[model samples]
Target: MTKERIEKILKAGANVVLTTKGIDDMALKYFVEAGAIAVRRVRKEDMRHIAKATGATMVSTFADMEGEETYDSSFLGH
Candidate 1:
C-alpha cells in the first residue's frame, strides 16, 4: 500500500493494527511516525479473539473504503 493509503487508515482512528500478513518496511515507518503500532503475522484465531474482545471488525480489502472520501471510524477497535 502507498503512503496515502496508510494515512487514510491512520486517519480512521486506528492506532493499533493486527494483521495475519507481513507489513512492508515503508508502511511500518509510516505507522511508527504516526504513533501507531502495527503487529504483523498474528495468528488468525488470535485476531478473531482480539476483534471479539475489542469490538473491531476485520477487513481484507480497501474496496469498502474506496468508494468513500473518508474512512469510517467504526472499523477501529476501542
Candidate 2:
C-alpha cells in the first residue's frame, strides 16, 4: 500500500500487519513510528537471522490477500 493509504489506515485506528519479503531498517522504523506491526517472510534457513535482525515475527502462509479488507479498528488501544 502507498504511504498515504497506510497513514490513513493508521489514523482510522486500524492495526497494520505488514507482510513483505525483506525487512529494512527504514521500513521497520516507519512501521513503528506509524504504530503498526510488521512481519517479514524469509527462507526457512534464514528465518532466525532475519527475525533477529529486524525484530519481526515470521509466519508461514501462502494465501493470497489482494483486495481483502481484513483490518479492524475495534481491537486497537484497549
- Candidate 2 lDDT trough over 10 residues, lowest sum: 69-78
TM-scores for all candidates: the values are 0.88, 0.36
List candidate 1 stretches off by more than 4 Å: 65-70
Give the per-residue lDDT digits (tens) of candidate 2, residues 1-55: 4455456456656454544476666666667887687566645656556555655
Tens-digit lDDT string for candidate 1 (1-78): 678778888989999988899999999999999999999999999999999999999887776545744556888878
lDDT, candidate 1, at 36? 96
Best by lDDT: 1
lDDT per prediction?
Answer: 0.87, 0.54
TM-score for candidate 1, please give it.
0.88
Give the CA lDDT, 0 to 100, for residue 72 in model 2: 39
